[model samples]
Target: MKKVLLVFCLIAISTLGYSQISGGIKGGVNFANVDADGDPDGKTGYHVGAFLTVGAAGIFIQPELLYSFKGAEDFDLTYIEVPILLKKNFAKVLNVHLGPQFGFLTKAEADFGGGSQDIKDELKGMDLSAVVGAGLNLPGGLSAGLRYVLGLSDIADNDALPETKNRTFQIYVGYKLFGN
Candidate 1:
């Protein structure tokens, strides 16, 4: 019984230490929207980030640091967002990811009667979001993926304008630092 227990511990330790680490840069564009109360319109934005991957077999975890721009076009509202997700590969060239995101209202620009001007505080300051996506590995160590960012927290404080939330779709291109 003692010998069996020792062998079991050794196997477990070996498996835990056999993971590989990889790092790379990723960037993408977002089709964003600020859902107020009624119709939802699309806006243009983008994100840039760095990622670290640790994995064994077909499963992996990827942690990313990103700077993202999000907004609505008709209303002309924008925010800076950061998202982190854990990813798992189910096939040799396919994977899925889901995680949480937080955003800060940075600069807001709008068109007044005379001309466009920068506005100070039109909405809430911070927002919380949920992210989910799928990825495909391409040729030459490159990968492409698409993600959806859905606002889970309200960003509006005014009752007249209605509570608003953010929704976005992002397409990403990335390079694998290390993985099989």
Candidate 2:
């Protein structure tokens, strides 16, 4: 876990040297659910992260690191997620993004009237998903986007349990450290 974070930081630091490279902090609400019995029920959670974008000729590659809180009802799961997106800028105002996202489980717990109990042992360590979204580019590198994350792998660890997959809707606002 530490090594993964370190690598992300290293890439972030390296992006600072280029005029076309920008990185920033982002945080927003997440409507997360599991696809067990259809839409399932979503618990509103939050995600905070940092992202770096490298662009050339209106095309860009963006990498983001985020800590996201997911799950709902009786259980809550926390994850450290990495998303690498390919973006196409249009009219210098809107950008469409699509790519793969990887998630590492950091914590898992169940809440009852009594309190909370750790359930990490029963959970899987990794999650893979697909992300698709669009962002509105603004001055000063401040931007906003709405995206959906659809799980490509089942998160269930036991065969006895139902087939579970993640579904998340995210809306975020970001501001680059340096003006564009």
Best by TM-score: 2
Model 1 lowest lDDT segment of ten: 73-82
Per-residue lDDT of model 1, residues 1-180, tens digit only = 999999999997897789877777888898888777666667788888778777788677777777777767655555566676788887668899888987777766665466777654666788899999999978777889999989998777666667778888999998866654
lDDT of 2 by residue, 34-88 (tens): 8875555678999999998887678888999999999867789899999999999
Which parts of model 2 are misplaced by more than 4 Å?
Answer: 1-19, 112-114
Candidate 2 local distance difference test against the native: 0.89
- lDDT against the true structure, each candidate: 0.78, 0.89
State residue 169's C-alpha deviation in candidate 2, in Å. 0.3
Question: What TM-score would you give candidate 2 relative to the actual structure?
Answer: 0.85
What TM-score would you give candidate 1 relative to the actual structure?
0.78
Each candidate structure's TM-score, on Cα atoms with residue i matched to residue i, is 0.78, 0.85
